[model samples]
Target: MSLRALPILFLFAAALTLTPISGLAAVGLAVGIAPPATVVETPPPPPPPPANVWAPGYWAWDGTKYVWVPGSYVVAPFPGAVWVAGHWVRGGHGWGWHDGHWR
Candidate 1:
């Protein structure tokens, strides 16, 4: 391959890798009817194992009804990373879920 073609190939590869990530973010941007607020009961936290952190559960829409996911301890994907709890936000049309991410 020519030297000039190498940069174009690298750019093409980068675009391909980032396409799926951008598409996933777009999918989460869909707005839907707001779900009723759920009152989550706090359960006593169990002893955490080494290098694990407690992830609080939240209500999720299952396309038919809201389901409560129980909280549990989750090991961090990488050192110094923290789990951000998911949340429902009010949008122009209704409500949407912002999935949690490690930061």
Candidate 2:
């Protein structure tokens, strides 16, 4: 490889390594404002499809407003996996959402 190409290759590799780190940083940002009270709604019965799990929706910060995401049935990521619903918790900086994950 040419000498100039080596620097470019190094930059490309560095960018690839840092891309996911930046994405994770964004995902971990905590909202400083407390979301409004959650709306109570009765979820409809599960669909006829088997292995469908209920993912209860919550308010999501849109960088401008708190948008309500309605609950719905979703397919579990894997067999025997349970969906842990996301929730907002009080933190040092007002409130932040703890993202849900499959358990």
Candidate 3:
């Protein structure tokens, strides 16, 4: 409402236009910025039995900027399941998350 607040509001809007996505898929979260490129991570040695699949690192939006979520080994849901990495997608509203799923 005041002129002093206008600059702060503008800065927030600017930041959104240069950053990443929603906060872990809320009911309806949209981000104006496109996510940064995916981080290249060399996965560590596989863990013990049943958890050998490496879900590579990805950039996650933390309501502000993109944060690097390190890759980790996870157990496959089924006998021979393949892991599909999640990524950012552009939609009518804005950028949103396409959560990774098993194949």
State which candidate has the highest TM-score: 3
lDDT by residue (1-103, candidate 2, tens digit) is 8998999999999998876553355365577778888888776964537788878879987666789999888888788999998998887766677777899
Alpha carbon deviation, residue 53, candidate 1 (Å):
0.9
Candidate 1 clashes between residue pairs 3 or more apart in a chain or in different chains: none
lDDT of 3 by residue, 1-103 (tens): 9999999999999998866444424446678899887778887764548756889988877777888899888898888999999888899998887778999
lDDT of 3 at 81: 96
| Model 3: per-residue Cα lDDT at residue 33 | 90
C-alpha TM-scores of all predictions? 0.60, 0.64, 0.67
Candidate 3: segments with Cα more than 4 A from true spot:
1-25, 46-51
Regions more than 4 Å wrong, model 2: 1-26
Q: What's the lDDT for candidate 1?
A: 0.75
> Which of the two, 1 or 3, has more lDDT?
3
lDDT of each: 0.75, 0.79, 0.81
**If the candidates were sorted by their TM-score against the true structure, best first, what order would they fall in?**
3, 2, 1
Collision count of model 2: 0
Q: Which stretches of candidate 1 lie over 4 Å from their true place?
A: 1-33, 38-46
